[model samples]
Target: MTFEAELRKGNFQVAECTNCKKTVWPPSDFCNQCFKEIHWRKCANEGKIIEFSKQNNYYFCLVEFENTIKVIGKISSGIPNKDQHVRIKRCGMTDDNYFFEFSLI
Candidate 1:
């Protein structure tokens, strides 16, 4: 149902550019940054949250991967930006996973 769930289940795939060195979280054939054909790789289910926003009872987090790829996800639990480290927590339910703008112990 959610984009993060889709990605975790492998229903949704992402792509990154090896040329201009950009990552496309939703996966695209063309690089939006360089306007070039994209060469992509599969991502492991891990990333760090760099930013977050709350709206209308919904929390959104911006997740950054190793290749500088950024994806937005939801925070199912914990306080944002309190730990000073960017981290994402994956739960078994997929829906329960929380992405935070800071790390947690």
Candidate 2:
């Protein structure tokens, strides 16, 4: 399925930066780099895993969303980089929710 299709099924909103022209997830009002009032735009849900690590009780991946915005999230049950495309990563304190994250493949 495409990113737009996922948006239709889900209720999450897309985010971007007005000053720096960057896209962000989890909807931030301030740009991480410029610290300006950010804008909101529909994301492509396409990105790359720039960095990843396992720290005790958590698996973290620093995903560069849309080749512009980088965000970190927990990894799901799968071999790392097996899928280059956008895949779901488990989130939340109890590890129930799954959000999009890309791999190098």
For each candidate in turn, the TM-score is 0.46, 0.47
lDDT of 1 at 70: 68
Worst 10-residue lDDT window, candidate 2: 88-97
**Candidate 1 on 17-65: residue-level lDDT in tens?**
6678677545577777887777645554566557778877766777666
List clash counts for every candidate, in order: 2, 0
User: lDDT for every model?
Assistant: 0.56, 0.53
Q: Give the TM-score comparing model 2 with the true structure, all chains together.
A: 0.47
Over the stretch 1-105, how does candidate 2's per-residue lDDT look in tens digits? 222343445523456678777665455667677778875555545556666777785557776656655556666554445224444332222233435433333
* Highest TM-score scorer: 2
List the pairs of residues colliding in candidate 2: none
RMSD score of candidate 2 (Å):
6.8
**Over all chains combined, what TM-score does candidate 1 have?**
0.46
lDDT value for model 2 = 0.53
